[model samples]
Structures are given as C-alpha cells and as structure tokens.
Target chain A: MTAALETFDLCKTFGALKVVDRVSLRLPQGARHALIGPNGAGKTTLVQLLSGVLRADSGRILLAGADITTSSQQRRVKQGLVRTFQVTNLFRGLSVLENVFLAVSERQGASRQMFAAAGRRRDLIERAEAIIEQLGLAGDRHRRISEIAYGQQRLVEIAVALSLDPKVLLLDEPAAGIPSRETSLLLDAVERLPPDIAILMIEHDMHVVRRFAREVSVLVGGRILMTGLPHEVMSSQEVHSVYLGQAGQKRFTAGVPHV
Target chain B: MTARSELLERHSYNPIEALYWLLLIGTFFAFPNYLSIATTVVIMALFALSLDLVLGFAGIVTLGHAAYFGIGAYTAALLASGGWREPIIDAVLAGLASAGLALMIGPALLLLDGLPLIMVTMAVSAILFEAANKASWLTGGDDGLRDFSFLPVFGLFPWSVYGQTSYLYALGWLALLFVLVRRVVSSPFGVALQGIRENRARMRLIGSPVIGHLVRAYTLSAFMAGIAGAVHAQTNKFVSLEVLGIDTSVDVVVMLVLGGIGRLYGALIGAPIYILVKHFAAEWNPYHWMFIIGALLIVAVRFGYGGLLGILGRIEAWFARARGTRKP
Candidate 1:
C-alpha cells in the first residue's frame, strides 16, 4: 500500500533538550493510527511538525510523495493536510455555522463578493449543514459558539477542520475537555469518516484508543518505543513499564501491561 | 434587537448613513449658492470620515494621520503655487507624496503596539511638522505658502475660493473617496484585515502576512487622507504648518473615537458633532468649550470603547428588551 504521509529523520530541539529526536515514521493509506505517550514524550511536538505548524529543525515531510515540510499551516491545509487543536481555536464571536461557513468560504474564493449575500450560497450552506448533521451538530449551528455545550464545541472544532476538505486529518486530542457522552459522539464521527482518507490522532483515553485506533505508536522520551496493532502494543511489558513509572530500568519485556 | 442582530444590522448601511451622506453632499453643493458655513462644516466632516476608515475598520489606532494630510497640502501648494501647475499633476503628486511617507513609516511602526505605537506615530507627525517649519523655500515656513491657482477639473471649471465651485468640487471629490473606501473595506483584503484585528495569531496561521497587510492598509489610508488634504489646501488657497501639527492629528483620532471606530458612517456622524461643538466653543469662550468637550469625551469612553455607536446600541437594546417584556 502507498504511504499516505511520511516523516524522514525529523529533528527538533529546544536548547539542549531534543523535543523530537530524529524521528521518522510512515503512515499507510486508510490507517487509523494513534500517537500515545506519557507526558513530555513529544507526541504533540511531532504532530505539530507533521501538520506544518512548526518547522522541523532537520527533516522532510512527504504528503502523498510530495515534500511539504517547510510549507505554512494554511498551505498544508490547502494541500489536504489539516489539524484540529488540543484546545478549540474557533471564531467564538460568530455563530457555529458561521465558523464552518468561513472555512468553506476559504475554498470557494467567494469571501470577496461583499455586496452579494454570502449566506445565500446554497451549495456551501448545504455542505456545511451536511458536515454539521453528520457530526450531530445540526441543532446548534445557528447559535453562537460560546452558547454551545463543551462536547458540542469539540464537534464544531472537528467540523471546522473537516471544512477544509482534508485528505489527512490530524486530531490533537479531539476528546480532551468534553464529557464521556460527547466523547462517544466525537469517536463516532471519526469512525464514520470516508474510508479513502487517513487519520492520525493523538488521544489520551485508553477507551478511545481501543475503540477508534487500528494501529498505535507509543512515544517515550521523544522516541517511538513501539508501533503495531493496539492489542500487540498494549499487551507488551515495556508499554507497562513506561505507563507504570518504571521506564528507566526496562529493556524488553512482553506480557499484559498495566494501564 | 440582540447583539447578534445589532452586528448584522451594522453590516448594512442604514438610512442614517444615507441621511448623513445626503446632508453632507447637499450642504456642500448648496453652500456656494446657499451657505458658506455649511461648506466649511462639510469639508471638515469629510476629512474626519476619511481618517475614521483606518482607525475604526482596520483597528489601526493612529495619531499621525494628519502627516499625510499635511504632506498632501504641501505637495499641492508646491505643484500649483507660482503657476507651476497642472490639475491632474498636482492632485496625483499630493497623493503620491503622502502615500510615500506613509509607506516609509509603516514598516518602522510595525514593531510597536498600543501606547508605544501611538507615541511613535505622534513623533512621526512632529517630525513632519518640523520639516515643514524648516523647509522655508519650499513650504514658506512659518509664513505659510500662498497664491495657489486651483487646478481645473476636466479643464471646465477651475477650483475657486467662492462658495459654489469650491464647495461642489470638495463634495464631488469626497463622494468619490467615500465610494473607493467603501469598496476597499468590502474586499477580501478588508476582511483579512478585520480578521487580523480579531486575532493576529489566527490570521498568521491562515497565511496572512500580518505586517505586509498592515503596511498596505496604512499606505492606502494615507493616500486617501492625502486626497482630503489636497482638497483642503486647494479650497483655502493656502498650505499651513498646522496641517502637520499634533493637535490636528489628535483631532482626527478624536473624530474617529467619537464616531466609533471601525464603523464607516461613524466618521460622518462623529465629525459633524465635533465640529458643531468646536464651533459653539469658539462662540462661547473657546478655552472653556474645550473643557466641556473634554468632559463629554470622558463620558463617551467610560461607558463603552466604541464611543457614540456603542451608547446608541445599548439604548436600542434596552428599548427592545422593554418592549419584549411588556408584550409577555
């Protein structure tokens, strides 16, 4: 299978500490991969580098075989690589639908047609509505983003990311702040996405990991400790050592791991 | 109406905006044949509105906009004085000179924010004021430049000091500037600027070159101010250092604040109120009139950051709430 996204020898350093230490990985097409690690394991930093939010001090990122390591965040989005924030970054003052509309408008190039009524664009509105409905956000579209429930806010964040028509969607803890009820809704939306696209997600909850991710990569101290099926990775002893506060002495051990 | 409805309504130009424009043009047009004081009021109102475009819509807080205005006046005076003039040449030169100065200063001003930026911009105006003062041969220095022959538009009617022609000329030019500014604010460029005002980091993440956009906006706004300045100089047949003074710069910002920043018609609404107050102040003890105006300004700012429009919006909301309550 062709690789959908690949990072080659990516390195990033803040002073002497290597936040991402010459890491490299290739994600195949249609793979639902997870990046999981203990705190300060560089998972977020790696995601930032992959999504072109931060420049890799030394490396290249290939999106469908095209180098886009140094491109801007918006350029990467335009090229079908988009990301959601760990914290929701939205136009909070505007309505929920307006947020989605602005993102869609970015694609239609109709943001400049000032005198013409922009809300009248039936096709764009329909597309936005479909995304909202698919995410179970139809009832909240007309309300200001601030008025929405927290779980709904997470859905809207994903909706904004989806608005870019991305092929490779990066979700940075999509379930972070919401209650468990909204978490399931978010996971459902992820599962139901079209199969042709690839998703790379950073998730903290083990339940979400077991439910949504087909493949998992565990990062410990800025390096990928293991990559494989979720069961295989989770059933390992080293994964347990890292999770159980004994990563410093472990070499290689295999069996059922602790939380 | 709720805040959302008020925001939506603000996007549309209400009848009040139309009325302001109508009264402005009508007064200016009728002045030569109707009244002189009305022409003066229209000219100041136009100048104030032009400054408000950058101050309000673009979220650019400036205190040196009058530097461009002064530069425009100087350019017109230099080009048209002593019979060294072509109408188009004078107008274009005035605009170019002012815009050039704005462009030169814009980049340097980028690193500053809030009071620092305001202070730096005020310094820029002061620098221009000194230049105008010291450039005796070119600008006539403290004596001020005089004897400007008004450039004839379309070679049909030359600019005149008499009530009708000058007033009509200023009105026509003001109308054209207003349209041009309206088009700019409604463009994608304007939307991007507004986005920057709302969130700079987000705008950068979305691929807007923040400094580049701001510089372009500042240059365009300065160019418009230049046109206003050229009109002012030609109207009075004189170019004075006061155009570059700190007081004039403060006055432009005051007009914007009073009218409410970022609202185009605020400039129109605010300018007339300011001028009328100033006019009355001059009539009543000019010094004490300033004290009264200062007190009013304190009240305006204390209540809301958006000035008169914010106050008006709050009142409208209160009435709507009252009506809704009564209905149930």
Candidate 2:
C-alpha cells in the first residue's frame, strides 16, 4: 500500500547550510512515528518543508500517493496534511473554544459562512466541545489562550490540529516545555486520536518517544542517520557518537534511560 | 446540561445590545439642537466601523482607507451631478465603486503585512488624493463638487434646512449597516478572519485561505466606508479632495482606537466621542483640540488596552465577581 506521507530526495538550503539535505522519509497509513535529533538537526526544517511552510530546493512530497511538492499550505491541509508548531502557535486573544471552533468550522467547510453566528452553529460547537473534552481541556474552553498555562496551551495546540481531522498530523515537539505530569495528559490525548490518522511527532523526551512512537527516525547533520524501533534507534552507537556526545552516550546507554 | 447552558449563553441578551438601542433612541431627545453633529457622528461611526472590519478583525494594518471613502464620495457626487439622484441607489453605487477598487487593489496590497502593508496603503491613498486634486476637470479640483441636488428620501421627506431628514437618513443607513456588520462579525467567516488576525500561519495550516479572507473583508469594509462617504456627499451635496485626505484616514483610525479596536461597537462609541470632541474643541481652539484628543488617546492606550469597550468589559467582570458570579 502507498504510504500516507512520503518525501523523496527533499533538500533545503539556507545559503551554505543544508538545513534538510536530500532527506527521504515515509510514513504508512496509521503509522506512529517519531523524529528525534540533537539541536540543529533540521527536524523542524523538515517538518516545515512537509507542511508547505518552506519551499524545498529539490524534492517531491507525496500525500496519499499524489505529488504535492508545490501546493500552498492551505492546499496541503486540504489534502489531509496538517501540522503544529514547536512553539505553541495559537490565537492568543481568542478563547480556547474559539480557537478549536475555527479549526472544526474549517473542517466542516462552514468557515466561509458570512451570515450565521459561529457560536450558534450547533454542529460546530458540538464538534468543538467533543474535541475539547477529548483533549481533557473542557474546563479551560472559555479561557483565553494567554490565560492558560503553557502545558495546557500545548494541549490546546494539539486539540486545534486534531479538529482538522488530519490524515497525516505533524506535531513539532508537542510536549517540549510541558511538565512530566502534564506530559502524560498530552500523551493520553495523542493516544486517543483516531488510529487511522498517521502521526509523526518530533519529541526530545525518550520516554515519550518510546511510549508513543513505534518507530523512530534518528536525524543528524540534516539527514536521517537511522530508522528502527525506538529502543534500537536509541541504543544505536551512531546516534550516540553523533547526537549525544561521549558523556551523553554513556548516560543514555547505561541500560536505564532517564526520561 | 452543558450543551443547553452553552446555547443559553450564546443566545442570552448582552447588556451592550440594550445599550445600543438606548443610544439609538436617546439621540433624538438628547441632541435636539445639534442634530447635524449627531448625523455627522453617525456617518463617522459607520466609517470607523468599516475600518474596524479590516484593521480590528482581520489585522490588515492600513494607513490609507480613505482611498475607498473618497472614491465612493466622488462616485456619488458625479452620479448625482449627472442627474442620477436616487439616494439609496446612489449610496449603493458608491459602495460598489469602493468595493470594486478594493477588489482591484486588495489582492496585491494584502500580500504585504505590518509596516509594508501600511506604507503601500498610504501610497495608494496618496496617489488617489493627488489624482483627485490634479484632475480639476473631472473632480472639480480644489473648488469641490457642487450643484448636485439629492432627491428627497423616497420623494416624501425633503432635505430640510434644520437637518431633520438628513439626520434620520444617515441614522437609517447607520442602523442598516450596523445590523449587517453585527451579523458578519458573528459569522464563521468573521471568526476565521479573527483567527487569521491572531495567528495567520496557523490559520493557513488549518486550511483557511488567509489572503482571500482578508481581501473579502477589505472589500466589504470598503463597501461600508463607501456608503459613509456617499452619505457625506449626499447630505452636503458636495465632494472634495479632503474626502481622500490622509487626515480622514488617520481620524478614523483614531476613532477606532479610542473606542476599541476589535469590538464592533468600538467604532460606534469612538466615532461620536472623537467627532464631538473635535467639533467642540475645534470651535474653542482649532489648533489645540488635538492635544486633548492626544491626551485622551494616550490615557486610553496606557490604561485601557482594549479601548472604551475593553474598559467596560473589565468593569463588568469586576461587578460579576462582586456579585459572586463567574466571569464569562
């Protein structure tokens, strides 16, 4: 079967630096994958290219077996490719419900309605409420994003992305700054997403990577160094020498990985 | 239970709605001698509302919204002078003319954001202002357009010298546009525009056509502003280069900021406050009225971040807390 998302020979250059250099990756339908790298490994840049935020110098991106390398961000989203930012990008002034309602409305194809009040739209509100409940953010629904804690804001970001009903969701470090206790909620929220929706998460926490992603891709120097099961990728010597330095390599592979 | 409460919350009558009606009805009794200024206030409110649509809601930072306003004024003046004197039709034609200009320029102009967007819009209005000023034959140059007679409202109420009919005419237009704007901002499209305003990149990733939505909102705003300009021309039976001036553009922005930026009612509140202050202060000392206005703006910005409406919102929240009610 064709992979849900595939990037072939994708290359992006910022002057002399190859942020993403000829990187090819694929995720089958319903595949749970994680992309991990040390700082400046071009993981975020790769996500940007996939989501159409940045144009690739050379490559083809296939979504459900169709080439969409030159599609606009909105077009890419319409094709079932959605993404979240590493930094919580949300409508800061708007209420959390309003933020999710916008995403739900977009998915329902009702976002263009210029007459009906969005709040009074039963379908939109119901869907938004359901998504909020699913993400365990129902209590904070009415609060402005600015008022919510950073951890809750991260969940809100995930909730917004999930509202789009994406076929391929690219989460760029959804739990980066979230506390360990709150990270469980984030993990649970991710776990509860519809199984058919393929997920590619970029995470730094080894526990999150192991618990969530069945397969992990270790990226170094703007290229995928290895792709395998979480533990295998984690224990690999290449990832250790390149990503984690000698001290990190010893601590990481000490048979007890610290989350 | 939650769903029912949500519906009730959505359908509940906001106190501001009552305030709007009260203000609308109180004008006749409150300002009997100054109906002309009142009418000007209503027109200015509509102009500010138009700017709020793009600037407040969509976050399209424009410094030259007067281009559409002037175009509408000129279109109405030209049509009336040419003997097409149907008031409603003329206003609509003026609105369409403005919308048409926006449609033409919005796609290209809206591609820019922040400072560049402001500069481009300023340049556009500047170009139009210069064109109107230089095209003496067509636009009457500095002498202004005159000799146009507005047909009576439905040919029943004549344009009275006491400004009764004119006041009512402008108020009717204001009421109509106010309802239309209220309906629009509550709509899904309006929410999406707000989304774009708050986070444009995320909006795009959610499949919202950001630029397209901005263009539409800009066109709609220009349409309303055009109507305001047409009303000005029709009431005064005149159109001048000043209609397209930068001052006109800046005045509306000040009015919007003074009242509130994002809230629709901000325009209504800001316009009257700004205009009335200008009217009285200018009479007292034309050169120094700006100082009072400037001071008021600084206070509003420094203390009340959301403008008048924001201050009222805070007061309401405080009252709710006092009453042991949860803040909505």
Candidate 3:
C-alpha cells in the first residue's frame, strides 16, 4: 500500500563513465512503471543495482522502507524483489513446466528434500501449472524450452520470474524479439498479473509501453529527463527532441509522429 | 497399449542404462571367479560415479577429486587401526571427514571456473599428496597402511574372511551410494544444478544462489568420493599417498568422460570399460597403455558428444530409421 521500491541518489561508475548518474525514483505498490531509454542509457545496469546483481557506487535501495542495498541476489529475491533478463534465461534442456516447478519448489522451501521424487511435490506442480496457465503457456508446458518458439521462450522466462512469488517485478525488455501478435500475449500476461505486484519494465516498443504503463521514466545519457503519466511524457518537447533528434521540427505522438 | 503405440513412447532407456545393467549383470556373473579384479572395478566405478556428480551434473571440473578419495581412505584406515572398528561409524565419519576437506577446499576451488578450476584442484591434490607422504608417522609414509579388519556390514557372518567379505562389502556399499546419489541428482537440487550449468546468471535471478549450490554439490560429490575411498581402503586393506594423487583424480575424470558426462550411469559404464582396457593393456604392454588411453580419450572428446553411449545412440537411430521406426 506504499512505495514498494525506492532508489535515492543512485550512482554507478565503470571506469570514468557514470552509468547510473544520481538516479532517484519511487515505485509505489501496484504501479506499472515503464523505464524507457536508448541503448546503453544504463537501464540494465540500474536494474542490476536494484536487484543486488551489481552494487551501486553510491545509492540506497529500500524495499517497503527497509534498506537492501547490500543484500545478496538470493536474499533480495526471497524478500519478494525479482528481476528478469533482457535475453531469455531458462533451463534450455528442461521442460517448460519443470523450469517453473523448480522456482515454485524453491518458493515452497521443498526443493531440498533429498529422497522424495521432485515430481511428487504436488503443491509445487499445481502452483506451477496454474501460473503457466495464467501466462498462456500451459499448451507448451510439457515441451523442452529449446523446442519452444522464441516468443514462447520469452514468455517462459517471465513465467519463471512469476513463479518466484515476487512483490516487485523488474522486467528487462520483456517484449524484445517478440512479434507484434506475440507481444500482446506478453502484455496480456503482464496485465493479468495481480494488482498487488508492482511492475517496472524496460521497453523499446513505445506502443506496447503506452498500452500498458501508467507512468513512464525516460532516461537519456544515463540521466532521467522526465517522469510522468504516459500521455504527459509523450507530449513533452524535451522528450520529443531527445527522441527524434533536431531534424524533425514536428513532434510525434510516441512512434506515430516520428514515422 | 498397442505394440506400435507402446514402441512410439519417448521414454526409452538411455543406452547408458542398458550398459549399466549389462555391466552389473556381467560383473555379477563373471566376478566371483576373479574377485580381486572385479572388486577393484567396483571400487573404481564408485569413484567415477562420485566424479560424475560434479563433472556431469554440476559442471564443476576438477582434476583433484582424488584428494577427498584419499582422505576418506586414510581416515578409514586410521580409525580401523586405532581400535574403532565399527564399519558404519568409520564410513560415516570418513565420509564426513572427506567431505569436510572438500568443504574447506571447495570454496576456494569454486572461486575458479573452466581451466582455472582444473589447475587449482590439481594443485590442491598435489598439496594433500605431499602432506600425506611427509606425514609418515600417521600415514606409514610410502610403505602404505595395511593389516586392518573392516567391520561387518549389518553383522553379516559370511563377511569374516578378508577376500570374500570385502568384495561383498564393497558391492553393497557401491549399490547403496549409487542409489543415494541417483536420488539426489533427480531431486530438485539436481535440477537446479543443471540449470546452473545451463545458465548460472539466469538461475541466480530466479533465486538460486549459484555459488552456494556449487559448493553444496561439490561437498556432496566429495562425500560420495570419500565413501568410495573408504570402501577402497577396506577392501584392499591398504591406504597410501597415491590415493590422494593427481593420477587418481585424472582417472576419475577419464572414467566420467569415457562413460559420457551428465548421465548418472555413465560412470558405471565408463569405469568398468576403463578398468577392462587398463587390465588388458597392462598384460599387453604396460609401457604403452597410457598412450592408448590418451588416444581413446581424444577420440571420445572429439567424436562422441555423449561418449560411447552417443555412438550407440546414433547407430540405434540409424537402425530405427532403416526399419521405418520412430526416433526414441
């Protein structure tokens, strides 16, 4: 019911480059916040910092008012802070259902029982199946991930994250490489996610972003240019200039006007 | 189920499984006549399986796994000589002690990956071997420790004789450890380690602590190797610095690779094949046997993706196609 995630005065440096330069933002519970930026705008680096995969040079990341700047990735995940990669990351040889079941097994604290068959973990399997069904992945559940289509692979990656039972989900380009038709499947999955789960996604497709995001934070040259509701941020001249460059004297409504 | 429908099922036995049963049955039928060598094969198979847990499943490459194997052997030897003759207690403690050494070294070894892991593990094995060699008072130096009785497993009476009892004892221990390790690899932890090998970064983002899992796996693998070592010591009634040496570790890796990496029963198939080849080579030409092994190893790596099983699998596929049958 409050700010589920907060980053204050965040900074990260690699050699002389300040990848995330004094970035500050608060993601309130249930807010669908979109993080859009040009390539190498430090968006992935920021995600890494927030998820404890990379430590911030100088900043604070508080989840539900508790500082988790130095927590391990596993601990951060256990605290309901989860993130997905821009590239599809899944157990390539395992069946799609098994990958999600592994996540659910970990969540249920039953993965370590040595003697019992992993398949016999009924509760874990049921939960995994339900999540797969919710993500529209049930048809492909029994298939090996490598055998699945690329779009389905991306969906499986998100489904793996969803099975973690996260409170705050950070998705790095969830729609990348997915076709327009399949992109809606991703959006539908995101939209159907429980409202209590706060989502922060990085996306290049502005149309997809505008369809789903309530708020958007625009990053330019490793700094936030402006953050506002989708329509307001789209209408801003600074955003337009930065997005389209100086050649176009006219403004585009997201992708349309630029075209 | 109809014959064609049942034959179409995808859950056919991996060729390795067929090899395992063949070897097990073959050994059971053939070994009592030549108990000494058969016993040795069983011991080697146990060691190979332990190595498989790390090399095949966890993707942890080690050329020094023999360090734990030797430690277990030495522990069991020392404890048996010190008037503590309970076989179960000796084995459990020896396994713990061996795994303890692994736990001590696994963290440092876990810091390295790929070729560096091999280098560090070999270095560690060398260090342990030198220490055992120099610690003459405890280890009996290069003379090797002997003249100890292994306690009966579950008070079995026929196991009072050295040769017969030891062979059965080792056979039973190998079976138990095999079942246990097999259970673990199929468990959730096993699947997670497989995930780690495929994409560790992805596994981490999904809440698996990659390094922690690796360490745990290494420790468990070490424990299995230790148990194998303890069995080796009891059956042979001798423990020496050579048990802790790099050659033994290399043998473990070779056995795993020869069988096929990643498959559990690969070790069972690979170890016996390794021992048979070695035994035959020793009689044929002890001097050039290592060259033969080295050449075969290179062939396995270059052509056999899943080792001997892979070759057999391809042949099976070809045969199935010729018969107008489906792929397994």
Candidate 4:
C-alpha cells in the first residue's frame, strides 16, 4: 500500500548549517511513529518542511501518492496533512469553543457563510462540543484562552488540530511543558483518535515514547540514525552513542529499566 | 449541558439592544437644531464602521483608508454633475467603484504588516491625493468640485436647507449597513476573521485562506466607506482634495480607537462623541479643538483597552458584583 506521507531525500539548509540533510521518511496509513532526538537534532525542522511552514531546498514530499513539495501551508492542510506547533499557537482573544468551532466550521465548509450567525449553527457547535469533551476540555470550553492554564491551552491546541480531521497528523512535542498528571489526559486524548489517521509524534520523554509509539526513528545530526520496532531502536548502541551519549544512556537505562 | 446551552444564549436578543435603538431614533427629535452636526456624525460613524471591519476584526492595519472614501466622493460628484441625477444609483456606483479599487490593491497591500503596511497604505492615499490635486481640469483643483445638485430622495423629499432630509437619508444608510455588519460579525466568516486577527499562522493551519479573507473584508469595508463618502458629496454637492487627505484617514482611526476597536457599536459611540466635542470645542477655539480630542484619546487608550465599551463593561461588571449577582 502507498504510504500516507512520504518524504524522499528532503534537504534544507540555513546558510552554513544543513538543518535537515537528505532525510527520507515514510508514514504508512494508521502508523504510530515516533521521532526522537536531543536538542538541535532538526526534528522540528523536518516537521516544518513537511507542513510547508518552511520550504525544503531540495527533495520531494508525497502525500497519498501526490507530489506536494511546493504546496502552501494552507493547501497542505486542505490536503489532509496538518501539524501542531512546538509552542502553543491559539486564538488567545477568543473562547476555547470559538477556537475549535472555527476549525470545525472550516472542515464543514460553513466558514464562508457571512450572514448566518455562528452560534446558530447547531451542527458545527455540536461537533465542536464533542471534540472538546473528547479532549476533557468541555468544562472550560466557554472560557477565553487567556483564562485557561498552560496545560489546558496545550490540550486545546491538540483539539484544534483534531478538528481538522487530518489524515496525517504531525504532533511536535504535544506533551512538552505539560505536567505529568495532565500529560495522561493528553495521551488518552491522542489514544482515542480514529485509528485510520496516521500519527507521527515528536517527543522527548522516553516513557511517552515507549507507551505511545509502536515504531521509532532516532534522528541525529539532521539524519535518521536508526528506525525499527521500539525495543530494537531503543536498545541499539548506535542510537545511544550518537543520541544519548554516556550520561544520557545511563539515565535512559535507569529511567526505563525494562526497555 | 446547561453551560453549552448558555453559550448559545449569549447571542440571543437582549432588551438593552432595543433600548439602544430607541435612543438612537429618539435623538432625531431630542436635538432638532443640531441635525447638521448629527448628519456629519452619521457619515463619520459609517466610515468608522468600515475601518473597524478591517482594522478591528481582521487586524489589518491601514492609515490610508481615505483612498476609498475619496474615490467614492469623486465618483459620486462626477456622476451627479455629469447629469446622472439618480441619488441611490449614484451611491451604489460609488460603492462599487471603491470596492473595485480595493480589490485591485488589497491583495498586494495586505501582504504587508505592521509599520510597512501602514506606510504603504499612507503612500496609496498620498498618491491619490496628489493625483486629484494635479488633475485640476477634471476635479476643479483646489477650488473644489461645485455646481452639482443631487436629485431629490426618490424624487420626493427635496434636499432641505434645514438638513432634516439629509439627516434621515444618512441615518437610513447607517441603519441598513449597521444591520448587515452586525449580522456579518456574528457569522462564521466573522469568527474566522477574528481567528485571523488573533493568530494568522494558526488560521492558515486550519485551512483558512487568510489573505483571501482579508482581501474580501477590505473590499467590503471599502464599499461601506465609499457609501459614506458618496453621502458626504451628495449632501454638500461638492468634492475636494481634502476628501482624500491623510487627516480624514487618521481621524477615522482615532474615532474607532476612541469608541472601541473590535466592538461593532464602537463606531456609533465614538463618532458622535468626537464630532460633538469637536463641534462645541471648535466653536470656542477652532485651532485648539484638536488638543481636547487628543487628550480624550489618550485617556481612552490609557484606561480602557476596549475603548468606551470596555470601560462600560467594567462598570457593569462592578455593578453586578456590588449587587451580589454573578458576572456574565
């Protein structure tokens, strides 16, 4: 079967630095993939190139067998390839429900209606409410984003992404900065997404990587160092020496004793 | 479930809105002698409303909105003097002309943001202003366009010297545009504009055509402002370079900021207060009236981020607390 999202020989350079150098990745439909690396491993840069936030200097990106390397960010989203930012980017002045409703309405093609009141769109509001409830944000749906806690804001960001009904979802550190207790809610929310939607998550937490991602890709120096089943990728010494080094390898072993 | 239902309830008709409309209509009888100034207020309010649509809702900063206004004024003046005496048709043509100009420039102009965007808009207005000035043969130069008479409203109510018909004519347009704009700002399209305003990058991620939406909004806003300009030309039977002046553009922004930026009613609230203050203060000293207006703007900005509406909202919230009622 054709991969849902595939990048072949993708290369991006920032003057003297080659941030993402000839990296190739394939995410099949419904695949649960994790991308992990230490700081400056170009994980975020790779995601940016795929989402069209940044143009790749060289290489091709194929979405469901269609070459979309030159598509604009909005066009990429319409093509079912969507991503969340590393930092929470939301409509801060609007209510949480308004934020999600805007996404849902766009999906429904109702966002172009200028005369009908948004509140009167029961279908859009109902779908938005269902998404909010699914994400455990129903209680705070009516509150403006500025009134919510940072962790709740993070969940709202995911909720906005899910509202797009993406075929290939690129999550950039969804659990970053979220408290451990709140992280469970986020993970549960992610777990509940429709199975046919492919997910590629970039996470730094070993525990989350083990719990969520079935397959793993270890990236170092702007290239994928290894890709295998989670157990094999985590246990590979090449990934350790290049990514975790000595001290990080010891911490990884100590923290995840079973792996 | 109750909370979810309450979300929809917020959009329901409030009794206060009825009272507000009644009060606006009541002003016609309450101050008959001030009808001329009142007509000016109505025109400025429409202009401010147009600015609010783009600046407040879409977060597209512009300092040269007068380009559309002047274009509309000149279009209407030329048509009326050139023997096209149908008042309503002239206004519609004027609006369309302004919208056409906006459609051409909005795509390129809206691509810029912040200081650059402001500068470009100012440049557009400056170019138009200079063009109108040098094209003396067509526009009557500094002497201004004269010798034009608007046909009576529906060929019935004549243009009275007492300004009653003019006030009612401008008020009718204001009322129509106000309802249309209010409906727009409460729609999904309006919400999306707010999304664009608040976070444009995220708006794009959600598949919203950000620049396209902004261009449409700018075009619609120019259409409304064009009507206001046409009304001014029709009522005065004149058009001049001052119609496209930077002061008119800057003044509308001040009016929008003074009343409130994003709120729809801010235009109505800001226009009358500014116009009335200018009317009275200029009477005392025409040269120094700007100082009072400037001082009022500083107070509005320093104290209330939402302008007067924000201040009133705070007061209402305080009252609700004092009465032991939960704040809405």
Query: Could you tell me the lDDT of residue A58 within candidate 1?
Result: 96
Off by over 4 Å in 4: A15-17, A244-246, A254-259, B1-12, B325-328
Evaluate candidate 4 and give its CAPRI docking class based on DockQ. Answer: medium
Predicted candidate 4 versus true structure: per-residue lDDT over B1-328, tens digit per residue: 1244332343466677777667667878998887888888999999999999999989999999999999999999999989998888999899999999999998998889889999999999999999999999988989989999888999999999988888899989988998888777778888888888898878888999888889999999999999999998988788999999999999999999999998888998899889989989999998999999999999999999889998998898779678886544
Q: Write the per-residue lDDT of candidate 4 for residues A58-112, one digit (tens) a residue.
A: 9999999999999998899998998887889998877889889989999888888
User: Please, what are the lDDT tens digits per residue for candidate 3 over residues B1-328?
Assistant: 1122111122233564555556655665676667777778788888898888888888888899998899899999999999887787897789999899888877777977999988888898898899888999999989989988766677674444436666666777788888787777766777677778877777776777678888888998889888888888877778878899888998888988888887766787788788889889988998989887888788887888888767776788779778875534
Best-performing candidate as measured by lDDT: 4
The interface RMSD values of the models, given in order, are 4.0, 4.3, 6.7, 3.3
Q: Please provide the root mean square deviation of candidate 1 (C-alpha atoms, Å).
A: 4.1
State the fnat of candidate 3 relative to the true structure: 0.52
Better of 2 and 4 by DockQ: 4
Task: Point out where model 3 deviates above 4 Å.
Answer: A13-22, A39-41, A57-59, A246-259, B1-31, B151-162, B318-328
What tens-digit string does per-residue lDDT give for candidate 1 at B1-328?
Answer: 0233222233345565677667766675554454455555555656676676666665677788788889888888888876756655676678888889889888879656678888888888998899889989889999999977764776888655565666777777767777767666655455555666765665555444667777777887788778778877877777889999988888877766786777776676677678778778878996688887787688779996678887898898889889999995
Worst 10 residues of 4 chain B by lDDT: B1-10
Task: Please report, as a residue range, the 10-residue window in candidate 1 chain B with the lowest summed lDDT.
Answer: B1-10
Query: Native contacts recovered, in order, as a fraction for each?
Result: 0.15, 0.73, 0.52, 0.76
Kindly report the docking quality category of candidate 1: acceptable
Predicted chain B of candidate 3, TM-score versus the true chain B: 0.89
**Top candidate by DockQ:** 4
User: DockQ order of candidates, best first?
Assistant: 4, 2, 3, 1
Report clash pairs, candidate 4. Answer: none
